[model samples]
Target: MSVDRDTVLKIARLSRIKLEDERVEPLMGELNNILAWVEQLDGVDTTDVAPMTSAVETSLAWREDQVSDGECAEDVLKNAPVSEYGFFAVPKVIE
Candidate 1:
């Protein structure tokens, strides 16, 4: 399939692209080449190919989901500019 100057202009307008008048012909040729390659791909047969979700075949490595001992609240809050009641305090944004 060949792309014309008018088709290139229409595509540029649809894509919200600003194209110079001189650049239109070359852009149309490139677009036509891309379309022709796609047309060539359409002739290939994929009757026995299985659909793939991922390129690599592997299982997710997981760890035990259990709560463990954590750092002391005072130790964490020690670096805060402002802290109160085991929490960091900041300026209120809304009334």
Candidate 2:
């Protein structure tokens, strides 16, 4: 794959960046070099390689699923400026 000057200009326009006429050639050269480097990866043989989700091999340590409240309602309500019943009270927002 190769990037031409026109392609570079199109990319700049799509990204909402202003590319000066003199800078287009330099950007085009850079894009072409990046594309060539990426193309080189296609030559690597991966037929026998197994797919992997992470570079480091390790099993996740998971805990048993459970549901429980903090059981400290009185302790938490003490910090509220104005608590009503068992909940925090705030200014009425609607008419």
In order, the Cα lDDT scores of the candidates are 0.89, 0.89
Query: Distance (Å) between predicted and true CA of 20, model 2?
Result: 1.1
Q: Model 2 scores what on Cα lDDT?
A: 0.89
lDDT of 2 by residue, 1-95 (tens): 78887899889999999987899988888899889989987898989988889988899988778856688989999999999999999999898
- Model 1 Cα displacement at 75 (Å)? 30
lDDT of 1 by residue, 8-74 (tens): 9999999999999999989988899889888986677879988797889988899789867677888
List where candidate 1 sits over 4 angstroms from the true fold: 46-95
Model 1 clash pairs are none
Q: Single out the weakest 10-residue window by summed lDDT for candidate 2.
A: 62-71
Stretches of model 2 off by over 4 angstroms after superposition: 46-95
RMSD each, Å: 10.7, 11.0
